[model samples]
Target: MTSGPSSAALLLLADGRLPAGGHAHSGGVEAAVVDGGIRDIGDLEEFLRGRLATSGLVTAAFAAATRRSCPANGPVPDGIITELDIELDARTPSPAQRAASRAQGRALLRAGRAAWPGLSCPLSAPHQPVTFGIVAAAAGLSPADAALAVVYGAVSGPASAAVRLLGLNPLAVTALLARLSPDVEATADAATVLSERPPADLPALTGPRLDLLAERHRAAEIRMFAS
Candidate 1:
């Protein structure tokens, strides 16, 4: 039997219209822009590319793995999912970033559960990927689709922030997304590797500079984004 949700379901999860409170967070782009790392559309695009390669890829992998491992009619295995969440948490290394991630995850969970009833979501502290996987599974979406949605969300959220901060053209933003499509797919493929085994078996790779940026951003007296 097939293990994916219908196209409509995938669209719902991927749609920017979903009330997941994603727009409230900038995914760190605002801070980067303010710090001079991103000045214009080009810089924002580059930042997104690097982000998609590292944190973006990792999140997609975990979400995909969770979706694949979760059964349709039962609670997902806590050991596996919690391990993945902790891995993400540990890699983050920034208390601000961790709090921001968990905040978004909890918001998404509350909204998603209400929007789509009969879903099995854990009461444990949710990281973004864990909530994503559970929501995708509940919606009958496939791991691959869930992974793509996550990667797309990660990319777009920051890009949107760039547009507002830098005053970039919306059309340019859309084109940037088009250019990143191949990278997104490639990242999704890399994420799919997680389906082969649980998150614990995966090799360790974390970005330290990003963590520092998150921490620095938090300490700043003036800030537009949460983290």
Candidate 2:
């Protein structure tokens, strides 16, 4: 039998139905839509493209880095995870965005640890990408697997949101995702390349509009998603 987590584990983790509170988040897509920014699937496709290139790239790298920081079948170094969290916070400029990330991280951590007792995440609350990487390590997944998970979730979350917000056809969104698969694989591989670097060296890509929208979303009177 193989020693590490199987490819099926990747499928399970990447699925949106994992109950990680991801459903309540549009990954900032809702805020954009609320502002009359994204009108339909065409706009959503653009948003997804931009997100994948910017925040998606950076988060994927962080996931890979977090996995590298975690010890595979060994004790994790104290304070290392904390440092990773701080670095991620520096990358996230908005307070609301940070909170949203941590909440999801905590949820994913709970699920990840419970699902795989061998995995140990020292941070009580880490950034989502960091938790993903460390959990990937614990589950015997490679840095590439972590990257795949990160990039996939980054785009998929917003795409799912587009369906609900714009009342767009689900099949069209699925086709859009299918068309973007090659780019997703490329982004994951790029992120995997940065896995061995220190947190400081990881990419610091940002989305100013997404950050602004996050703050707006937090203060809104009525909203469907959490972030």
Candidate 3:
């Protein structure tokens, strides 16, 4: 994969402020917090670490793989993107998580189209990481760049929610993220290497608690975050 200085486009995509509808979702942290799985800063740290290890690594891998699937100048093939989407869906067993992913994907697709003309995917709503990979490629980002954005979002999303859900100090939360930097980088590096494999061969590590929390959140009559 081609490498260069971190492009401004990468920053734009990775920024949490991007209007991709991600702010509404907490990456399952809201559900966990409500379920008593996270009550303080220490619990939040462990949750973020677990998330980074499982879904974070898997999403990063798919993002890298998807970026490789889409050529820099050619239109993405329907069959190939579909296969990747299916593979990601299989990895996410929770229906709530699948629905949340598609919702975010649709929002991200709309935002990407505004910034990168001609950016289109076969599916109206692909998985979030798949859309992320496609958009990253459209913005002239490398596979590793895509992986970086995915893994970062994997933990950052939950951390953002934890602050709101648990009333955790923002400074502490930011510091926690700073401390997790090495882990985030390690996860991204591993994902980039795993991206060299076929989509079906990618890792399928999961957190059952995340799945249960997603289901519980979906059923809750009162909720702060979407999932």
Candidate 4:
């Protein structure tokens, strides 16, 4: 019999259909599409890549750090998780982005509670990545697994949004995601390594463009996405 942790839980968390309210937000893609920053599959790839390198990295590292802060078989540390939340808030400069993350976090927390009935999250409304980390830990996933999930979602969410916003071919978008897998793995690995740093020392890579896009999306009168 296998004694190691199973990958099924990780897969469940990463699945887009997990009812985490990820569908409502495009991760800034809708605003970018409205702003003419992405017009085709090629532009979408570039945008996803940029996101993977910037906010993606920060999110992955913070998720990994949060996972590390969680104990394997005990109550979650509220103090450490609170510190991580504040650090994540600091890293995310845009108010719209922060609100969007917390909204998703709340949704994910509900899903997490459903999946793991005994799950005890410290924060009522944690950031999305922090919630992801806490849920990942409860599901018996490693920090590296949590990091990979965040980076993958970071790109995949925008990629999926591009399909609806631009009418891009689903096959082409899937192919584009396949092509970016290596970079995603590398980014996740880097994030996992950086997770060893203190909460305040985690990667603070900011995406000013994404922040502006989020702000613009928030103000759009007839927008499809909430963020």
117-182, model 3: which lDDT tens digit per residue?
A: 899899999999999999988988888999998999998888999999888999999999999999
Question: Between 2 and 3, whose TM-score is larger?
Answer: 3
lDDT digits (tens) for residues 151-218 of candidate 1: 89989888888888788999999999999999998888787776566566653556665677788888
Candidate 4 per-residue C-alpha lDDT over 70-109 given as tens digits, one digit per residue, 9 for 90 to 100? 9867899999999999999999999999999999999999
Worst 10 residues of 2 by lDDT: 1-10
lDDT of 1: 0.79
Question: Local error of candidate 3 at 124, Å?
Answer: 0.6
Error of 3 at 182 (Å): 0.6
TM-score of 1: 0.92
Model 2: residue 178 alpha-carbon error in angstroms = 1.0
lDDT of each: 0.79, 0.87, 0.91, 0.91
Candidate 2 segments exceeding 4 Å error: 1-5
Q: List residue ranges in candidate 4 displaced over 4 A.
A: 1-5
Query: Which numbered prediction scores highest in TM-score against the true structure?
Result: 4
Residue 109's lDDT within candidate 1 is: 87
Better of 1 and 4 by TM-score: 4
Q: Candidate 3 — which residues are off by over 4 angstroms?
A: 1-6
How well does each candidate superpose onto the true structure, as a TM-score?
Answer: 0.92, 0.95, 0.97, 0.97
Error of 2 at 104 (Å): 0.1
Per-candidate RMSD, Å: 2.1, 1.9, 1.4, 1.7
